[model samples]
Target: MKNLVIIGGTMGVGKTATCRELQKCLPRNVFLDGDWCWDMHPFVVTEETVRMVESNIAHLLTGFLDCSEFDNVIFCWVLHEQRILDNLLSRVNHGGFAIHTFSLVSDEAALSERLSRDIAAGKRDPAVIERSLARLPLYGELDTVKIDVTDISAAAAATRIKDFLAA
Candidate 1:
């Protein structure tokens, strides 16, 4: 059976970095970033755009799931709400896949530090700090396994996920 690893976290919370590391650690895996679906020039966020991005993400992930070469599909996105997670999962075909959901979380201090560093490096916008911190609490409400990454490296977080799956 294949493995579908769904990772969710706030912006600048290491979801992308950890998933990238996870993709490297796992053989025969394809990594999908949901942000890529809505990576437009204007970066608009309307109801229609939201629906479009969700549809696009589901389509791309479903394609990967149907492919025969990949044994694992690693997806990372800002899946803060249980409703969003349920909606996405409902659209996918999980015939032979074991789904593992995880939410990466950290304290306000660690999150602020990370976002500040990213902003200084021009990797993210200044507004990301406020938005990310606001969403941080929502992860605790999710039904997925929570991984505290307050003081952990992305590679170490990836190892924990890999080990959890192995067990």
Candidate 2:
């Protein structure tokens, strides 16, 4: 059975870098960025629109799990609530796949700094960063491993994840 790894965290928390490292470590794994789903859609993203988007994502995940093309799947998303995690797990429950989760967190000041950098780089909007930071605390007791990326390099963070998975 293929293993499914989900990396959830706040924006600028090194998810993309982690995904790249995971890809290198587990070469057979297929990587999917959850943000790409939003980018693909052509609708205004209000609260209601976001809910609809998640619903559609749930359906797409179902299809991915049903297909037997990939040996392992590494999915990255900003999972802010346990309910969202539950919904994702429920959809991928079939396949005898071990579900592993990794959450990246940092201090508020550190996050704000990162947000400011991203804003200056035109990588993210200030409003989006504000909203994401506001929802950060909603990610209930993370059942899986948590990595604080406050002062670590992306390579170091990736090594941590690789070690965790190997262990």
Candidate 3:
């Protein structure tokens, strides 16, 4: 069976760096980022829009499953709710893949600093930071392997995840 690893976290938490390292370590895996979905239009969230996004994700996974090119998948997203995680997992489960999730977390101060830096770099909007921080608490759950990246570099964070997955 294919191994479907979902990396969930707030902005500036090194999800992309982790996935990059994971892809190198597990060469047979394919990596995906949620930002790629932003182009679908109407970036604002709504019940109908959320359903549509989920359907699109399901379709993407279906295509991956049909192809024998990759042995595993590394999917990264800012998954702030249990329902979103559950839905993603359900779709991959139907494709006969074993699933695992890793959620990166940091203290409020650390997150705020990261957001400020991102804003200065012109890579993020203030509203996006605000919303991400506001939803941080909603992501607290026992099922996820939460990694604190407060004082770590992206490479170090990636190494940590690689070690954790190996264990």
Candidate 4:
């Protein structure tokens, strides 16, 4: 059976790290980070930018879905709203794939600490961290499964996802 796993969360929530760890547990899979598609210089977020990034993600996923070599396709992104999630799913060609979607959750204090560490290490901008933190509430309102990342390692979170897909 073909499986499409979409993982969403706020910045510094270990989405990418979990994806990397998740890769070790699943065979014959393709993984894509949505942020990688937004690698534009001086990132702009106009209507055009949103549409383009969504289209890009859809296009990349469409390719993976069509490929015969992969049975699992893992997508990691920050999907904080229902409309955004609906808009993204609308662009994809499911082709009868079984989809398991989840949102990684974290407490405010843990989130703040993670972002602070990232900022101190020069890995993330203060403004970006602020924007990401502001979206945490939206994540809780989503319909998908929520995996709390507080007090857990990325690898452990990945294991949880793998177990979820198996069930």
lDDT of 4 by residue, 25-142 (tens): 9989989999999999998999999989999999999999889999999999999888888888888897869888899989988999999999999999888668887998888899
Better of 1 and 4 by TM-score: 1
Winning model by lDDT: 1
Candidate 1 Cα misplacement greater than 4 A, ranges: none
Give TM-scores for every candidate, taking all chains together and pairing residue i with residue i: 0.98, 0.84, 0.86, 0.97
The CA lDDT at 60 in model 4 is 96
* Ranked candidates, highest TM-score first: 1, 4, 3, 2
Q: What is the C-alpha RMSD of each candidate to the true structure, in Å?
A: 0.7, 2.5, 2.1, 1.0
* Residue-pair clashes per candidate: 0, 0, 0, 0
Any runs in candidate 2 off by more than 4 Å, and if so which? 40-48, 62-69
Report the C-alpha lDDT of model 3 over 111-157, residue by residue, as the tens digit. Answer: 88888888899988888677778877766773688878888876776
Clashing pairs in 3: none
For all candidates in order, the CA lDDT equals: 0.95, 0.76, 0.76, 0.91
Clashing pairs in 1: none
lDDT of 2 by residue, 52-91 (tens): 7677667766666666886668888888777778877775
Model 3 local distance difference test score? 0.76
- For residue 39, what is the lDDT in candidate 1? 93
Error of 1 at 60 (Å): 0.7
Candidate 4 local Cα displacement, residue 17, angstroms: 0.4
